[model samples]
Target chain A: MSAVLETRGLGHDYGSRKALDDVSLTLAPGEIVALLGPNGGGKSTLFRILSTVMDASRGEATIAGHDVRRAPADVRQALGVTFQAPSLDRKLTVRENLIHQGHLYGLRGPDLAKRVQVMLEAFGLTDRAGDYVETLSGGLARRADVAKSVLHRPRLLLLDEPSTGLDPAARRDLLRLLQRTRDESGTTCFLATHLFEEAEVCDRVAILDRGRLVALGRPADLVREVGGEVVKLTSDDPEGLAVAIRERFAMEAVVADGEVRMEREDGAALLTPLLAAFPDRILSATVARPGLSDVFFRRAGRAFEEGSDA
Target chain B: MRDQTWLPAFSLWQREMVRFVRQRSRVTGSLLTPVLFWLLFGAGYGGSFRPAGAPESSSFEYFLPGTVVLIVLFTAIFANISIIEDRREGFLQGVLVAPVSRLAIVMGKVLGGATLAILQAVLFLAVAVATRSAFSGGGPGPAGALEAAAALVLLSMGITALGFVFAWRVDSVQAFHGVMNLLLMPMWALSGALFPAAGAAPPIRVLMAINPTTYGLAMLRHGLGRDATGGPAPALAAAVTVGFAVLAVTAAVLVASKRRKTA
Candidate 1:
């Protein structure tokens, strides 16, 4: 019922450059919220603050009723964080990595062993438990990393780009397991990822742009904001066609990457007039309902910047 | 809640042990590097070299403690390099976020490195005993063996923690290696491991006496019934070694887990 995680105007600055600026977020318990943003979009900064590894320069964050800045120990006890990098030692076996993680949380003896067994079984890693982490495939290693993070079964799980570098099968399995875990145990899952598809499965998606929260809502509702259909007209001279269409229909048409695109209540009503107006310049036109990227385009104008190094 | 440092520290140590056991190259490298140094440097410098005021032991026998110390340094440096790599790749962020004390993490890593360093040096001690008996005079007795093992552990702890301090400050692996050479090598060379301070020039003798490692070597030499270069009494030597360990560990924890500006 209460917010599992909440941040108020959280900001971070790297010397003169601001990495996060006046960003606020709230996540409810047992809900899967995805922070979808391009690289350098402050997703990591927010995650770091939530994990209590980095102190916010401005404002505050609380995790599971404890302030992350003033009460890191409490926050840590409530949170399980999985890194983007290879945290498991390449030289140690998968089981050993889990064992170490458990001990870090003060789980020991038979209890620790039992937890490891449960995690290995849950993640389908029993067969590969004895294998060195370096020897395991990338997907298996990532599975081990995830399993190790949740070994102590913290109240909140924070994953950074968990789907990156994972194959489609592994990615699908990870989402399934996470969703099942949340449904079964009522654990809160908040993940930061750039993949729009990954965010689609989450209950809520918070889209960040250049260190600021640009949009926040359900993926479906956000896309629905750009309701009806979008028309993309491919032409050799998209700017000229866009001007022509702007004059003819008095509707705003934007050209991006040499493609003239516009949205309307009914895209078919505008396609005939637009094509007839620029028959020589326009090559083709297609009408389709807006997707998540279309939602982002509506909000940010340009497409989501790719390959951010947040 | 009261701090539960032991569990996390022990876990880190366990991970280090498991890693060392799994990597064959690590096992071989830690074991063989000291032996190679002892054979090549000891033999080459044996026949023609003799320090004034030194005992009747052959040069190879005299080089034993130095080679063992070198192994400890090597193992510590080797183990702490992982810290630099981990920080660069963000592996350490996972560990830092755990509800564990920063000191516990440092202790875990240092203890792990120390255990491996001491273990490898103890294995090499057998060779030292045999070579000393056959070539020089005789091996250290049971008391000497106990003393050598304890000294190796303290030396390992100090060196490993020192490596942690340097590795924490350096961002790249290349810089870490460069720092290890600059920090560890000079200390080893001047610790009366290679040459005794008794017959050295006034400046060199003073440097050896002032070096904390000189006391470690002195303790090692005394434990094995060998005379030291008048560095210090074994009691004082042990105190200084422990002191170095404490200081290095404190510095390391402070630097690596400094109050990061983001939570």
Candidate 2:
């Protein structure tokens, strides 16, 4: 499969503050990639540039072989986007909203009507077709939004945090629908999400922090890269414990929130010894398999939690 | 056959109509605000305050054109407010990512707003006609009323396009509301909607002369035969109104099409 989307050295800034700095990524046709990042990590800026809703400040991007800067209309024709916010007209019925969207894509007459019907049934919004969007539940409105985006049957789909406000069941439905969309229509789906669970389902995940791509790999690959357990120890004197740990293991430790954490290939084997070495200062110690958070910690040095001083 | 260029514009126009029906508060506000102003102001000002230009007209008769203008102004502002909300609400991002041209987007929205303004302005126009017959001793014939309605539509299209110029750039609805107050309120004040230009100070009169809605008000006044109010000929006013509508729409399209060049 060829690359359906590609970005090279994409950078953007709002005045003095840089939002995205020299980010590059690629996605194959029919692949689902999650852009995972905390808030203010430039996920939205990158998504906007890729969707051609906003131009990149100093880089290049192409969707479906059409350059975003030089041929935005062509890029638009090739992709569908579900925004982080609700886009439906609350005063209009679901069917009316879908039909209006269809018209914008130059669909009209019997064909437009038929597509509206198809989208309504696809999202299970058929019964609420004549009800105003404001009256629908949050999940149904979100489904209507996704349905509206895919009405044109574009080759790639971009959703900015589709599960932000959904219940678990609704989130599950969204996930299944996304996969079904890819399977049935051969659409490559890309979404920006802060939730690890949402990112775990993607075939590939790109982790961004501070406007840079810090890690990129399959979710499981990232977790397995530690090759061992992560040992986290809280101590009465974290500074003294960290110093003793560095002296004994000859390996650096990341200290965050009065706790010291380190990756250890033989963590289980050395746990008793490490505890003995720091018996006076050590308060508690736990060893666990690596998670996405551990992968982030490995790359960023800062704790995955926002409570870190960095 | 391919979808015609007007399809999107027509679709938006239909949506505006549907929303107008569903949202009763919007419908009530658009129709009632102008009438309330007219009645309260007309009764308070009384029938004796004819302007220097048209000395034979009653104050209520003179306020009729202004009432129609207010309806046009009110509806234009309220209808196009969706532009601001669409951005914060996400519908605009969907539109921005669509294959549709910028001209089509502006055209669809401006036309939709203009249609709604015209629809509501007609309701006020009917009340004006009835009041005129009861008090002014004369009113526009059927042909004249039709012409006045057309003028209201043209005026609505022009002012709504102007609304789009501000709305396309502002992200916040409150900021757009501020623009409406700081800019559109003055435009309406000098539009000869509240007072005739002949009675105003020279500078205020000049502002009225320069205001496009002033010409629209003149066109409506002449169509209804409310003594012409020292305005230019009806034909001249119509030309200016049409020219203003086209220019505002072109400006809006230009603003909407540009790709945030400052970035």
Candidate 3:
């Protein structure tokens, strides 16, 4: 089967400011991918382009082989979109929102009704189906929003920050529901999220920074490429400690947010020499296996949180 | 699944109806404003006011059709203004991304607004008829009632579509308020709703002559068998009103077709 979602050198600009630039990636059928980036890192811009809400200034995006700009209706038909902002009509009940969404997708009568019922049940919103969306808690409302989008059994599900405003338990529920949706119907799920945990769970993670696709690979693979371990040390004079480590051991160190961070093949072995070299200056030190943030730091040359302009 | 036009339109229209019914303040506000304006303006101008060529009827009788038109105008304004709200609340974003056509979205919103406007206009007309103050000469029999109803539908659709055009372009309800104050209210006020074009100054008469709504209200006046000497002939007015409705809806569809430049 062809790729469920594909983009070729996709870029967008707001007047003179580049919001996204030359970003290219693809998702296989039934594979879950997360575009992980901090705020202002072009995630929402990419989301808007893929969801067919805005046209990209350069390159192209296609959903199920339909170009988003030239064949928007076809792309819209094959994709389910859940925006970062809550899209449910607050005045309408949970069930009503699903029914209306189904209609928009051309599902009607008893078939649409059955789908709404099934979605409500799957999302754990069956009992609250009759309640107005405004009356629902943030988690319940987010579930309803996702439920309505997927009610028509779309082939590709596009979610933008699906975990925003969701509590820990609610976030887990959402993830489980997404997994179940993919397991049952082979829906290709692509979500833009800032959370590393969310990115780690996806089959692949795409790291966007400064409007560029800096890194893209399976989460574990990307982390593995970051080398053995990440060693972080904090000191009153982080710059001084960083220079001392570089001069004494000829190791590169990044001073960010009052911490001197470095990746090492043998962090356990480096700790002894590193502490001996800066025993007086080092206040705290930690060595742990590399993770997504380490992968981002390796690719983008900055801490994950610092990648955002804000 | 095949892309649907009318199915989505009908669904959106149904949603509008549900929201309107649930918001009690909206229904009441659209009705009360027109009635209050009729009573105040009618009583205040009763002694000195007289429509040209119809001296027997009180100002209350002359203001009746205009008041009913006002109800339609208010309802249209209220209904279409929800577009800005929907945009702010992210409801419109969902619809815009759907497989539904731009025309369907416009039709759904415009027709939904027209339906609400017409219902209120008819209700106000019924009350006016019960008091025997609706038509100028007397009750406009079944044919006249049908004509009046036709004028109401056309007028409601026209104004609602016009409102949709402005509401879609504006980003904020406050900006839409600027549109309402600058465009919509003045459009209604100068449409020969307050006074006859025959009795107005040359420049004012020109404004009324060019105003498309003047023809709609004139058609309504003709249907009610009121004195319509200063306006165009009934057939011509109906044509212009129909043209106005079509033009407004076309503009709305065009605006809806343009996707958001920024998300």
| Per-prediction DockQ | 0.64, 0.66, 0.73
Give candidate 2 misplaced runs (Cα > 4 Å). Answer: A256-258, A279-284, A307-310, B1-5, B130-138, B141-143, B261-263
Candidate 3: lDDT over CA atoms?
Answer: 0.88
Q: Could you tell me how far off, in angstroms, the CA of residue B71 lies in candidate 1 after the best superposition? A: 0.8
User: Model 1, range A236-303, lDDT digits (tens) per residue?
Assistant: 88888889889988998998656888888999987787777777888989999888778777776676
Please write out the lDDT profile of model 1 over residues B1-263, one tens digit for every residue: 63459888888888788767767888767779778888887778767887677766777778878888888888888788888877776667778898999888889889998889887877787666654532345567888878877888888888888888888777798998788778788999999888888777899888887787887888887776777755688888878877887788888888767877632
| Model 1 residue B255 CA deviation in Å | 1.9
- Write the residue-wise lDDT of candidate 3 on A223-308 in tens digits: 98877888999999999888888887887887966689988888889988878877889998999999998888888878887757
lDDT at residue A159 of model 3 (Cα atoms): 95
Q: Worst ten-residue run, lDDT, model 2 chain A?
A: A301-310
C-alpha positional error of residue B3 in candidate 1 after TM-score superposition, expressed in Å: 5.7
What Cα-based lDDT does every candidate model obtain? 0.82, 0.82, 0.88
Comparing 2 and 3 on DockQ, the stronger one: 3
In terms of TM-score, the best-performing candidate is: 3
List per-candidate RMSD values in Å. Answer: 2.3, 2.5, 1.7
Pitting candidate 1 against candidate 2, the one with the higher DockQ is 2
Model 1 pairs in collision:
A39-A308, A54-B262, A54-B263, A55-B262, A55-B263, A56-B262, A56-B263
